[model samples]
Target: MHATKGTPDATRFLELLRLSVSLVLIIFAQITITGFVGFFVVFLPFLSSSYSPGSLLTGMKFLIAGFAFALPWLGYWWMMYSLSGNGRIRGFFLLLLTSYLALIFICMQIDPVYNPEAMIPGSARESTFLVCMAMSAVILFPFYSLGVYIFVLRPVKRPRKRYRFLLLCLLFAVAGLVLLPFLWHSAPIVYPGLLSFPE
Candidate 1:
């Protein structure tokens, strides 16, 4: 009954949640879900018998989290862009590599990567999570494909009446700008660096 109360948390092959009418809602798959996924992946590796607020505050872990968080949105956009026939496969690698490099550059500006500890050992919950991930992906493949195609891929492919490439540039620029603040806020929290955040 509780599961039936709210909306499905994901539309792209991972219905991990049914969002309630609370402050935490499933609004932007490109941001919200992907970002959460990134944070969690980093976190799970770090979780162990001992936990402190500061356990997750290492540089390498933070970088991995950033990559994890950013990947989904980047993959969503890039994958769609690739299928759109707007450019060659070379362009896809160029964009992905460059953007990821840019992200690394920004992080380096704040603090360089440092792997200070070994990963926590496997736990009982790992199996549960694996099963859930596999099942959801298998079950939701069709919906994921359809959702991305209808909402993202089609519009991407439709740009440019005769090669002018009207608004595609602006669309990407906006997406980049929107991603910056998330990366920014997350940096200080995850890495606990130059920026001083409130308590």
Candidate 2:
């Protein structure tokens, strides 16, 4: 009788599948919670009684902002799972963090004014750009550092030159940082207050 390594292999595969499912569940839950909070807090009050372009635009802003709020954490997990290499992960994390902040800048530019009372956890008019940027750097740095080293792109006796990969990461990070400010500054068409929420 031959003993087999099949059981351990099957168990490992199942574990990986479980982790993937968990990630999906986490994303779904985040989207749902953000959607509800965003609706009452940011969207509802903004809808208008009379249909208008401004109101439509405002509604769009809410949806975009909600997605933007959800993107960073999702992006983090996505990158964490997808890539392997400390330099690459660090670069990806930086780039993703930059992009996430860019979205915040986008939301700031949309700058829809809403009544505090209508919102569940009310928002403020000021830009959260800096805050998001700071948070991204602080939160992701350690994770990026730890993750890259742990996940093997290909195990090595000695590390190989990965300058090109590092350069690419830098380029992405720089591009994200540079373009976000401009995108953040562009003014939007209208504010749809009251209709989205209520009196």
Candidate 3:
């Protein structure tokens, strides 16, 4: 019996797998922390009332839902970040956009009680989801771009012409708005019943 040596491709694959697992763990931690804070904020008023138990349970449900809804985009951002190399400004911007989108989707899905209609296939629900996604992209793009410009790009290299950068950002904003509807239609909803709790 002899041990077989791993090929370069296999070794690279294993390295990627390890990196992915680590990234996932980090993302989960972030989501858990965020969820806990959100739950506390939303459920604080119910603490002194008879509805405390129910509120606590609902808050827990929201926490779980938030984690589920955020996982996909978080993973997407992590992968993008890992591949970004020196051009981290673009990557960070992408991360911000995805995070904002995740928050928007989670907020839209929240209810005192679970709604099964969100998961059911119907034209109305689909349209609503599409609209929400597009609206979120539209709302977040400018903020995301500005944050990138201020925090990421400005420190690295000052632009010779600030107006040109602003113009570019505006162009990107317009492009994002134009493409959002198509993206909304094409993108599959990752966690349709994310707000639901188990029976």
Candidate 4:
């Protein structure tokens, strides 16, 4: 049998999953916005044509990134634990780090198959983007409930009112997965920019 929801093991496991997904999103969003230095993306733009930073700048970048990324996450957890009136447990942060690294390794090992060229008729970039999105919609179908639990229900301060407003989120997430194949043909129409990118 599964551990009850409020039990130590259950709570810890839920937090681990939430932290893993949130951190993965954070790392990727930072990469999208800043393109380097990973997580907080605090690295300075290249001062030399070689597209690299000096040693001092590199060190400074890492220092800033570490604090920038760590502070907010720590603050959120601090607030959470404080609200729950629980003593801080330090080891899970290390475990979270290990989980994030494992996720990175797993993602790197995935060789994405691209098949949108015929349907979307766009640059490799957009097609690849769409393919990844479609795959996510399909593969994550089962875990949408887990996502809702992590992102929505668990965060609610009121236990009784949790999931009241989030039923649609779960439905839409599942619907996308179910409809992706039928929707693939009209993707170009749906995403006007899909055809705008130069091949």
- Total residue pair clashes for candidate 4: 0
TM-score of candidate 2 versus the correct structure, residues matched by position: 0.28
- In model 1, the clashing pairs are none
TM-score of decoy 4: 0.28
Error of 4 at 8 (Å): 18
Per-candidate Cα lDDT values, in order, are 0.37, 0.40, 0.44, 0.42
Q: Residue 45, candidate 4: how far off, in angstroms? A: 5.0
Q: Flag regions of model 2 displaced more than 4 Å.
A: 1-20, 25-125, 128-169, 187-199
Give candidate 2's error at residue 14 in angstroms.
Answer: 3.7
Off by over 4 Å in 4: 1-54, 88-199
Instruction: Tell me the lDDT of candidate 4.
Output: 0.42
Model 2 / residue 118 / CA error / Å: 11
Score every model by TM-score: 0.26, 0.28, 0.31, 0.28
State how far residue 143 of model 4 sits from its true place (Å).
29
Q: Which stretches of candidate 3 lie over 4 Å from their true place?
A: 1-11, 43-109, 113-150, 158-199
Q: State the lDDT of candidate 4 residue by residue for 1-199, as single tens digits.
A: 7776667786678878877665665445433322222422312354211211223443343334333433344344444445554443333344345434543443344333334575743343434333334333334423442343354434646544235324534455345445444444454554444455554
Off by over 4 Å in 1: 1-27, 38-42, 47-57, 88-199
